[model samples]
Target: MSQAPTTMKASILAPGQIAPNILSSIVVFLVALPLCMGIAIASGVPPAAGLITGVIGGIVVGAFAGSPLLVSGPAAGLAVLVFELVRDHGLVALGPVVLLAGAMQLAAGLFKVGLWFRMVAPAVIHGMLAGIGILIVASQLHVMVDAKPLAGGLQNFGALPGRIWDVVTSKQGLEAGLLGLGVIAVMIGWEKFKPAKLKLVPGALLAIILATAIAQVAQLDVARVDLPANLFGSIEFVGSSGLAMLLDPTLLGIALAFAFIASAETLLSAAAVDSMHTGPRTKYDRELCAQGIGNMLCGAAGALPMTGVIVRSAANVQAGATSRLSTILHGTWLLGFVVLLPWLLRMAPIAALAGILVFTGFKMVNPKQLKELAHFGKGTLAVFLATALMIVATDLLMGVAAGIALSLLLMALRAAYLHVSLKKDEANKTAVLRLTGSATFLNVPRLSEVLDSVPDGTTVTVDMDKLRMIDHACLVLLQDWNRTAHARGCKLVVDWQALEALSEAGSKRGRVQGLTTT
Candidate 1:
């Protein structure tokens, strides 16, 4: 009875699990509500679209999810990617891109390629998150004042200082800015000072609730959430334009990006959630399929793409979730709230949600991670900086691509890398050529030069034992040099057995001067 084969569904129905599941679901629902609407609003879609993603993520994905306690929903991680698509191609293209991305994820899960995402370098992941964070903060600053953000990340950043001054000096955007600021302050203060009894209550929920109340009490004129009375009214399914756009190369590329980023984020969140709870380990491929189902339904319903969200999942675990029942019930709560109290959601000032997102975006930067990255080495830190800065200066796809390229290049250099040195004891009539790094075809030329530098008619010892690795190319070169050394009356005192052993071990490992030192 391995844990992997255990069906969590049966466990969910156990009477012993009921009370904890209900309590955790309520906490998760509270955590997710603001984030769902906020992420959707940030992605330039209607408020209801986010809620739609939340419902599908909980009900559809939860039932099939491999990580029983993990929660899923619309996430800030993909907001920048979605916002760019909506800005350039119009809202119509979003559905098809999401639909196609979901299809790709589903196919990948079926093929069991979910584990391949684990190969993505940690530097690239952190860098990508940091980059996304910068973009979110830049864009949401405008939203905080009830204004549309500038076209791109750089543009938003460039205009940020002037916009802040405007909010301070003028009546135009002052009230909304103050409300957004208050929301941010409350969230920070609450997280730092909330009582032990209220620790399970999410700061985002409390902050937004207080902000919404203040807006009403003060009779504020700031913009409110634009949720519709009827949930179906907000959905605009994949139109003809969206369908046609799917065939276009640019949109297809976007879809592929969506699949890659979403899968990485989802699987990573599942892993994080698993660490938070001792109950079950994640069955990655199954969890991926659940995400696929959730995202597919979200796309069909004209909603935002969803991922296993760490925020709500953390809340679920901390609140005492026992099984997938808590995750599923959270979605039920979301649907109930949306259907019954659309007015309450609509009454929430848009600035409040924007403020929460801004705080979230700021947290994503995590400046403390810089020191940790630097601890690994300059190269690791370089990858982090390159990825983060490139995403800010250019775009998400290109930044990630650049980081991967640099990481691979460094790896290749390390594999084919070699160092050669010659030490001659002329008084003793002996010359020793030392090789101390990976010896492969890439290092052959330098190996030949060092061997040639040894004086003729002198006993030469090529120190093979010092070598980290040796491939066939270097071995053959050494054998050729051995023949020439003998012909030239120089005795080559090389331990062929040890050298051959190194080559055989490396070959068995299918490495031609690879990561394993032999």
Candidate 2:
């Protein structure tokens, strides 16, 4: 007798399986806590909003998630967009934008539009991540020194040198900077040399916890994580906004951008997580729907938008998470800490959070990714660099668009070479013009010249046997040339059988004099 489907699912979620998940959840929760607060503060939203997104992403999305081990939360990749939106439209307007973006993601998933995002070039994706990493590192460096960056990635970068000098030279600044550096040092050292059994303890969490403890014990005069006594007071419902703001082109653009990045990043992270674990593969469309719903809940509750996050997900897998229960439990832990242990959070130094994020940002610009691109080819490296630099100099959407365009351009150029050969059979008064390789609009003039040099009406046999591809423009040129040669009574003949399956028009014009496949 076989077990029922419901029974099988229940068995998978049994109490025995939950113990490891619960343990993993605690590890992920610790890893996610500082990141949630830091990313929110970085995005210029209240830290609690980030916690809210983490809760929704874990419990809400995890309940329905297809990638069992993958965790979701507010991503640093979306931080730049959030900052820009909050800067331009005010915090109150963000909820509406998030709500609309969530709706779009839901529609996209339902329509099976998730596959389209996978079409983006890998270089562009890596470059986007690298750019976000650079931005995060530059911006957080200022925060680590207890200062606010001016604005934008470029401005922050420009001011970095002066800020570093000021921070290192001051007594207060030196203490804060060193504390942040100490946190970074702990994370790095732990990663390089943690005991085999203790490896499950996430380095980021340990670093923050240790740093906080030391700061408290030493009575350091440093800025700490500031949370209101009533954490609920931080929730601001932005369900309604002015009609003009809702309809504003900028607002709509930002929403679309958010939706695209969130969806793409979530799917990518899910895919990555699946590679690390053999338990279950991701159902991308279902994951999208879950993410969409989670984001919607977050927006409704006036929290940050959420997506599948690689860092926490990887940590969950490393910590032995076997199912979505781990993710859900981690969110529970976050909620419990925020509601019941606000004092623990208040003890964390702001610079410590900044340092943790800076370390995360550095990891994002992974040397492995860059090296892989280099090994692929110069063109791949070029696209990667261009996309990364553009993203840093411009905004995220524009940089990706540029990288895609460049990739397409390179593909077209590589596929555009044409090989044309003409053989004259003087004895039979027949000239066989052999065309090979790609024939595009770019090579139309060369093809036209070859056709014109042919003596008028000498039984021209235009053979496309070696031809790989021909564009519509080149086909039209061939047709006009055929007509002219026919008018001259010089018999132009060609076979269309070779190209019939290649073009709709070619099949219809079978046995024509100068047939082309486009």
Candidate 3:
């Protein structure tokens, strides 16, 4: 009878969720607009394509989202992937890759494989974010100073000095640089001193609005956002020929890569956002399926691929969103802005949007987070730094692989060092071996050496009370040793209750294979 109330509570919307959702949606709308356009520009695509993805992510995914407040859109995290795809495959081939990626995500959801994505090390995920942050900051800084971004991350970084010099000495880029600086200053000031009463208004939007107003008043000679006369009239769908590219192996591989990376990022964001609120937790499979549908729409519309963006999702939660309605309404607001007010958007300076991205990228590489990882110990810090450096030097997939390999190697080394103490009680003719810490396959040599030394006709006691975990291989070794001892006419009193408990739990789930206490 009491279970009925619990089930009803899960479905019922609390009375307090309505107003907050509406207000939060409006705030998210303002923040997401500039970000969508700026990320699209950074990815070498038309700004309208970013908005197309955003509209599909919000309206389509929001309606079916597992997490109520997790916003999906044209994420900066996916910008690198998009840029690479379009660069290598051409703009025409991007649609087919994205379409195949969507199909992969749909298959992942259908198989309920969302939990497997969580197995990725936290260090790897953080490193990926930090790397992406550095990339974003490096490229956008050039755009902020009214210069074209260089081809690669290192090239962009190397050219910053010249760009700054040009902005300082020449009259060409000075006004845009000033406007970009002004927007950044406003964002910082808004965070520190904005009144509590107007907190619902996002700092990014406020900064953009104030900067645009200043530029208009002073008649600053800076490039503003350029959009089609009728923004909706500018939308173009992918060519039918994209379907033919799906048969090509290289294009198929790109599609799979896009799907895998996007899924991991979205799952990470969903998990993070779930911790920020007390609402219903996310259903990962449902969220993956929803994202699949959203990306499929993006492909069909010839837009950018989408993901669950941490920036917008965090903003949604901080703005007091309580339901999926906030995400849905935010998409509605984006649609209305494109359809009703193209002139107002064109008032925004391009440098101002770059400033917003610069600030966001800075936030992603937080010093406090690095400090926390360092505090855990040298091993953790090493993994974190290695992942971060490799990502900056190489790429996302390679960095993650390196981090996971390092983590496993460290674990094996630590396991190999586990000590198995042996004590001989001469008076009772008894031998006791105490096992401590993890018992992995790496420790088998030392364990075997110690166990085999016991004399025949002796009473050997194996104490495993302090053992943390024993792998199947090690457990099998133990069982074999027990049989050998029995055949040698020695009484082997093995205390393996810990291993028994673990095996028992596994047995209940039909997962305890190759482990036995005979």
Candidate 4:
């Protein structure tokens, strides 16, 4: 919004921009490769589906993206929802549902509702991510050992101990599990102690390459990533059957949910990407629109839904990307790889990609964020934990619903909070009524009771300095009482300036005009 992002747009194909953008695109491509497949696998879809989303996200979304360096792709955050959708309605419903979701996003962006997503409680967002992370980790643990994940997040989590036991007892399972663990270790180790010279090389890419090398060297019979002979031939076009899904009310509801979550995730990621660079600030509505179009295309192709992912976006920025060319090129590279070299992809072990997701899942929990949330207050922390726990117990929608419910309850309680104390200064022949906390319609009765108990006024002073807010209801009550206070030979004293400042705008002048002041 600051500079309109025009300068960056105009220079997309500038002379010096080519090499750096290309270089950064390769870096982002390397980072995105495994994640594309892993997220799709987690979403209960094939690897090519994720690649299709990546391609659309980069080339299509990037073309219209407001944040030049931010990379969009199939995200882990939405994997749980997609998994549930796939589980409930079958894979055939996914394309239609995602298509509807994209249409909804496009409409929202047109209405300029993109900023509203930011109003979601930070605790809720983080907690939801944490919950999804837990689900991903629990489910992928089974995949790491070449086992099938259970039906639900709780089931997957509950089955962990049994899964470990199975790995210990079965030789083949043990080999796959050990290989997965080794990948995890490699990722963690590289992050902690990678040489400064090669820091730009992602740990994920290294881990996958090492995993493929190990699988080949050991001749391990683990399940590997399955890619089509020709990626273009694999696209599942939304035909007449897919379009029929629009008639189902349940699928429509799922589409709405998808749109909301995807938009929120995209805008939030764009905000984060903006902070990482000084070049151009994100125009959120534009970014949302771009994402909407991208998802629509992805849905048409029966691919996984896409959102702006922070990891790859961060990689793009750090790798010295100067324009949207980097984002577009990354998608080109992905499309090119799967088309020309599907054989190479077939060699990468599924256990290894699952391990990468496991690592990603743990990082998503982000316990360090708890400290920051704590600064807001205990209620926020409670919301965070409740959201995470509920997701583990139920599902993403329920967890988010619970968190939003709790957050609203907290707001209601705070808005109506009022503590009134009356002090009688007999020696001074006066009474002082003190107010603390917000004063709204909820507190009017208690406030009226205190005002009525002032013995018909012997110079009572209503002190509201400690009150955070005083609404019109309380203000009108005081004004009405003050009008009659003189009937007792003395006026009720009030702080007019403070009350005016605390009062809601537009009505403040009118309320303060009639209220008697000391």
Candidate 5:
């Protein structure tokens, strides 16, 4: 008797898998905890909000997300947006706007716009992520030194030198010293240690834990996060502005921005997860729905909006996580910490979080990948650099839009310049052209020009015997031309063998008919 298909299927979390998930979850929790607090404090929201979002993302999205390896949580990509929103609308007004943003995400998921993720060029996406990484490193510099985070992004970047000078001269030097040492240790450990080889130990987590323990034992007067104050601080679910704020146009605009950025990040991360999977493919629509639900729960619980984070997902994979159970376990650990070990969590050093982010930022800007983009074309590099610059100078959305627009324009120009001309024959009232080279959407304009410039009352015969490629765009153009010539009292004849040759050259695997001139 044959075994049932269900019985033959392999389980991602088979017996021994549970141990790795539990261990990886603990590592991810330690990694996420201080980051959650730091980003929230930096955004001017209560620190607990970030942790709350991480918990919700793990528990809610992790349980249902299509990508089993991806970890959902508060992303640094939204820091500038969150900070600007709070600055413009006041922290009190951010809650309702976040809720509205969650609803908008749900609506987008329902509309099946998740499929649009494929339309975005890979170059533009990489550029957006690289820019976000740079911004993260720059923004976290202040927090690493125990100084209050500055408001505007680029404008504040200019003050870093002066801030460093002040830190070097003041008594706060002791605190800065301890933080710097911790940052160095974390960075070195992450660079040198492989958790798999070490078993049950993540270098980043160990570095942070050791740093926090040392700080406590030495009785350092340096700045340390107060446990009780950081944890359980005043959290108001409904802000004073309430319903009116929900309907406010300005608030709506902010919420839309948040939703847009969050969705882009999540979708991009989901796409990455799809590429990493060796088994079955993930459903993007389902992933979007899960993200929407996760973000809504996050906002409702007084947390920042959540999204799938590539760094954490990569970490989960590196830690040998094979299923969503790892993500669920990570969230479970965070929840346990909030309930039972809030004090221990408060001992986390801000510098350690900064080190982790800095390491993550470095991974984002891979020189080898940039070199590969250069080989593709200058347009790819332009989009990548422009996006990176825009994110640094303005914001993520604006930068990404600018990069995409440039890429599209370049594609259009390339198409328009690719001409395919025909040689006229007055004796036989016929014209012939041997199409050669690749023809894509970029060549549509040239294809149109060649078709329109032919003299009236002539027989046009396109010989595609030498043509190497013809994409859908060129095929559509050819069909339209065939129709136009018939209506104009001219003749259009396409050879069947030639068409077959062209299709084979194009690798399109379709044959066209030999139609006589009308």
Candidate 6:
């Protein structure tokens, strides 16, 4: 008998494997620290919230997560939601709401809702992420150049003309000019530099460090990060008192929204990690549990809520992280820096963080992916564009909801237009039906109407030979029809190959199978 495949462990304790993970973890730490602070600042939360999430995600979730190379932490995907929550409710009120959201996420995992994330159309997901990228760049640009009254999401576009006029007329424009130059340099380095030419260092990291040094030397009047009053601070459980605000129905609604959105984003990120792993596939349920644990720790410790971050996970994969050990090490490095090098962190420039995020935003919006979505269908492209536009205009969750509704509506319209016809033979004892075009939930009622009109005790033949698609909903309908025909003592003949072909085509057409009665 062939031996069972050995499971690969994601820890340095695995014999003879410690050095590469240690080094890779260090690189991830360098990349994550600045990002943690910047994301918190952009989300209108204290920097410590981001740091707390990063530390817990790496040390707690990373230790138990099924994907060995994936990193978990606070992400830009949640920034818009967090910002809205903080704006509507006080900052202190956010802690308990986040805690409840974490609990809901854990419950979702237990109920296997993570699998539902895969049901979302790929175009919709891509569009939502792209919109978030646009938002990140817009929000951070103000901080990069010391501009006040930072415009967010689509609001920035409206304010752009006025902002540009002000920059042209004021001395404040000088810092903006320097920040813009730094962004250009970072982008160039990322696009042109070969991995071998800078094997030991990440281009974004190098660019940020260089930009910070330049800004410090010039003593430019640029905005800089203001470290928390309590550097190297420990999060206290007293933060949980913020939960009392949830007694308000509006606050509860906001918390539920946060829970749903965070669950979707995290599960999607976990799926991406599964795609990247060369080893065993990730167990999504287990990953969800890990995320829940991490989020709870984050909230309890006064940290921003977190999810599995695709950007950070991709960075970990690129940095030669082979196991979960690297994730653990990354967290360790964060703690070390916070406790031992607070002064050094103070020296890091805000411009450097902006450059890194700008690069990240670019990566999130891939032109090639858009081209691929174009090949699927016009409706898919429309949904993608609509989602992106809505996100830029409103917020991420609303944009996604709009895209999903559009996709489903298009699917329903396509189903309603599908054609199916029935004919009777001279023998009078037999009947034949031809199905054409797609059949889905929207077509089930019409199909049933036709079946009910057929004479009793007649031989029924379902000729799906010309049918382009038949979804699970249709399949179940057909199966039920077969049962009723049999109960009436009628012969039912189904073309298995035609049915298989329809199913295959339906899958390609993006129809999801519900319950299979066959």
Error of 4 at 475 (Å): 6.1
Better of 3 and 4 by lDDT: 4
lDDT of 2 by residue, 1-518 (tens): 12121111311776777787899999999889889999998888888889989988888899988677889998998887788788877888778888878888888888878878777788888888899899999888888888886677899999988888787566646666888999999999999999998988888889988889889999988888888776778877664453346688888888888888898888888878767755656788888888888887777777889889988988887777777888999999988889998888899888898898899889988978878898988888888889889988988888888888999987877688888877887777789888888888998888888887777557888888778777778877877877777676677686645554445466456636345543
Candidate 3: RMSD over Cα atoms? 5.7
Which number leads on lDDT?
Answer: 4
Name the weakest run of 10 consecutive residues (lDDT summed) in model 1.
1-10
Q: What overall lDDT, based on C-alpha atoms, would model 5 receive against the true structure?
A: 0.71
Between candidates 1 and 2, the one scoring higher on TM-score is 1
Candidate 5 residue runs with Cα over 4 Å from true position: 1-17, 171-174, 193-196, 226-234, 419-518
Give each model a TM-score: 0.90, 0.86, 0.82, 0.89, 0.77, 0.79
Model 1 misplaced regions, further than 4 Å: 1-13, 239-241, 421-426, 444-458, 466-468, 476-491, 496-518
Pairs of colliding residues, candidate 6: none
For the record, the alpha-carbon RMSD of candidate 1 to the native fold, in angstroms, is 4.6
| Tens-place lDDT digits, model 3, residues 387-421 | 76776677656766788899898777876566799
Off by over 4 Å in 3: 1-17, 411-417, 420-434, 438-464, 467-518
Model 6, C-alpha of 143: deviation from truth (Å) = 2.1
- Regions of model 6 farther than 4 Å from truth: 1-13, 149-152, 195-197, 229-240, 417-435, 438-464, 467-518
Off by over 4 Å in 2: 1-11, 242-244, 411-436, 445-466, 472-504, 507-518
- TM-score ranking, best first: 1, 4, 2, 3, 6, 5
Across residues 1-518, which tens digit of lDDT does each residue of candidate 5 receive? 12121111113657876887777777677667766776676566766788888888888899988777778898877876787788777876767777778888788778988777557787887787788777766666776677666665585688778777877887564475456557666657666765656644555566667777777887665555544543445455765557477777778877887887777778888666656545445667777788888877666556688878876776676566767888888888887787687777677666656655655565676666789899998888988999888878987668878988998998876644444768998787789855766667877777788778787888888776556656667776777777888677677788645554454343443322323322
Q: lDDT by residue for model 1 over 278-329, one digit each (tens)? A: 6568888988888887787788778999888778887887787778889999
Query: Each candidate's lDDT (Cα)?
Result: 0.87, 0.82, 0.80, 0.88, 0.71, 0.74
Residue 279's lDDT within candidate 4 is 72
Runs of candidate 4 with Cα error greater than 4 angstroms are 1-13, 444-459, 465-518
The candidate maximizing TM-score is 1
- Which candidate would rank higher by lDDT, 1 or 4? 4
